[model samples]
Target: MNTSPSPSGAHHVEEGASVRLGALVPLTRPGWVEAGRHLLAGLDLAVTEVNDAGGIGGRPLELVVRDTAADPERAAAAVDDLAGLGVAAVVGEYHSVVARSAAARADALGVPYLCSSAVLDALTEQPTEWVARLAPAQSHGWRIYADFLLGAGRHRIAVVTQPSVYWASGTRILRDHLAARGGTVVELDANELTPEALCDALVDHGATALLLLVGQPEPAVPIVRAVRSDRRLAELLVGAPAGQPEFAEWAAVLGADGAGIPFLRYLPEHLGPLGERVGKELRARLGEAPSFVAFEGWDAVTVLADVLRSHGTDRAAIAGAWPDVAVEGTRGTIRFSRTPGIGVRQWAWPPVQVVDRDPTDADRFRILRTG
Candidate 1:
């Protein structure tokens, strides 16, 4: 997991060694750990392929790793360690809050930060050349959900979100979009999330569809369990798969969704060449499904590698190439603006729905609409 500490001033690449790429990712639980493993595998494969074809600017590549763990304090310290190693730039997997905290540290230290999975608007609302995202912001995903569900007869929507900014504000964008489509937000957070309290909110508001913006399994698991507990109120429950894998550990409990599709941009079990091959390689090394977060780790490395390879110790050339490069990611095309606050210019891989046990194939998630 690359958890060791780096010596001070080690951020600079060796005198004539290939340029180095740095990545920060969460190695611990409740989200994207397995899939992340596979993602890194695919990314390494991409890097190797790039180098084998012919070195960029006649230099090889070095990829470094840092564990961001999901702790704000630890994440802050992590960027410092990475900076000391003279990393060219970074991309990582974690929450937008961590991205925000770490990016500030990275920027001040003169290291650019590009996020691959963290997707909250607050993470990138102010323009900065050193920070950017490879993932789309929350509102974009929410809008897609709102447009499709409302058109498909999901009226009287109830937005069950936690107090987190990721859920509270971003989900509101979906709420506003839905209201514009003639779908009323029947219920908001409704404060107290007790079973009795939730029932009262649903009963009083008469919500027909439920939009879940909650991440972490604590409240999310309970909310889903509560929804499942009352069969009388079953309705559409949906959100990104990145946040649901935590719930997968206790699948028996979270699997309660018999009537909804947990959205996922990339599904590891069903993978392409780079993904399938790398998944196996990572398992051989990491001994797991390669948390999807690993891909964020891997992509961060490859992107930095490709970016730096073009620069060859020229940080400016490296930084400039970042804003408009696109790669065919497992989810879809991954592209971004090197500038920050633009959020990720990328869009979600076309939404894939779980229909009749056939998500293993691409035909499953039909495109009813686009947000």
Candidate 2:
């Protein structure tokens, strides 16, 4: 966990120079900004813990963070800056499209990056040299969602997605997983065309349940209303893990039917075991309660800290050393891609209902159905 230079290598590594790491997280957006702050807090706490424990090989760990604003374009620029700073590695890219851009930048600069978020299915193909994952991939969500539907003997699913690449890429995985379960999909492109277009979609897509792959919060209103307005569309809901915050405004504006799929790794109030520990540490550091993004941040930092602790802080060393490390994440079971340079796993693909209000606990979210 230390970044200090040993006696033999002390001459090469300047003494007391902080080993800088970078994070390209979406920090300007509404809920995600809160998420980014939490992640930053966790990273800060992790770095503190590392230094208090004697630092990474005796070198102080310094983190350089950039706000990608939940935009892929901004994320690309942020990664460029991180690479310019000669950071050993970076952690966390929330949106897959943003990660794609960062991955490209990481490739050109030869910097190691961990895609802790942005589980889009196609992110694995992004060209990067030193990258690791603290979570599973976007396809995992599809696979899990598919498993749920299949276990229920539900076939013929309706698909709704943003034209944005995140959902676009993930929907394919959903399709493949559903197909594996003998489910046929009737697809509709809800590519931010218009409210009318979105409203018409529910009437058009013929299936028992609907899968929305959009990452934005605004569209939920029209979609939810469309589904509720149409009595023909039963089991109207989303398959992605959009929590209550993102879905809240839409619900308040258009009112929700209390139906849909919400695939989340950890809930805020009931964030499992790791969440309990991480949450406490995060609160201590940030001086406030952690939000969703904090978990993502902790996942990235702890993974990087572990790799640095075991493998050494050098880029190649971190990359070469991370293959077999499996750490218990906030959500649970975070393992790196044994392929090292390959990528992160898409995780937390479990499905819950997209409810109007936060249920007392996770159980009600899973138990109730409105579509």
Candidate 3:
């Protein structure tokens, strides 16, 4: 058995005896560790349940975990290593840029990759059957968010953005969607401007809503604080389409100030029987309510396990099985199809919601709109 240590830690699993799935998550700094934790919780819970029920055809389902740390180069290297290690397929990745790199590398290496959380529409530059994604495309989800902004009567939108492919794509989506609806989009460089200066720009530009397309804690938190403290922008709506507010860390850091900032989430309004059961189990595993990312992680494994059962661990066989997949996930019936503009096979759309923390109770999420 190959018991080599990974960058994060050592994952012990039977080399040839077990069916292995490579898990790529951001478990370290610069990576959204909270989301990674929830994702891992769901993945672990599903793997445990799968094994308990009688692993893939009596052979144990093993997950070899790797921490991407939100780095694209690091993620690409992990994919290479996982492929070398003979993982049946590679799974999981929260950052779109990182997932894009991993996807390109996996495709080149002929390894099947199921992206869990990255929403970038163009996961791969060219159409390839090797990569598939569970999250709604950035265009799909951001357009819904644009509609939500329009419905709320916020016409003048401002985006606080950084220099990243993911953020740039999101800004472009929002701009095109909103501009077609008689709305305007203004982009403010998060790296160039201080939090206070961003608030000033919001006022100067007469923006009614501001979307944060930047990373957490460093500038996102500071920008929110500056905006909240500035009375001039009292009527302004603070939004995060990237779903930074979905995690407990957002509430822990921003408290009541973080509430009312609508963000995108991929979850149904109400849980079904399986969803309810999974939610309970995930909560117990996570020691708190699970984010939609956790559901994505669980659904990823659930679909993969079903695929492995029907089609063995052959890489090409698994990649070819994407179209035939029809597993009941925690959110809904999961399936993959060729979505136009998205190179990789995609779960057409997961349930998208514009949610925010209830002002009275920061712990409770209030669904403002669904699409």
Which candidate number has the best TM-score?
Answer: 3
Q: List TM-score per model, in order.
A: 0.76, 0.77, 0.95
RMSD list, candidates in order: 5.9, 5.8, 4.8
Q: What is the lDDT of candidate 3?
A: 0.91
Note the Cα lDDT for every prediction shown.
0.56, 0.60, 0.91
- What overall lDDT, based on C-alpha atoms, would model 2 receive against the true structure? 0.60
Residues 222-274, model 2: lDDT tens digits = 66556666656555544544343332333344443543345444343346876
Q: Give candidate 3 misplaced runs (Cα > 4 Å).
A: 1-16
- Residues 55-165 of candidate 1 have per-residue lDDT tens digits of 556666656766666666777788788666666666675666767777666555556677766767666444545565666566555565566666667678777666666
* Clash numbers, per candidate: 24, 25, 0
Question: How many pairs of residues in model 2 come into backbone collision?
Answer: 25
Q: Which candidate is the best by lDDT?
A: 3
Q: Where is model 2 poorest over a 10-residue stretch in terms of lDDT?
A: 2-11
TM value for model 3: 0.95
Candidate 3 per-residue lDDT over residues 1-371, each given as its tens digit: 11122322222235348888999999998999999999999899999999999998899999999999999999999988997787888899999999999998888777889999999988899888878899999999999999999999999999999999999999999999999999999999998999988888999999999999999877899999999999999999999999999999999999989999999999999999999999999999899999999999999999999998898877777888999999999999999999889898899878999999999999999999999
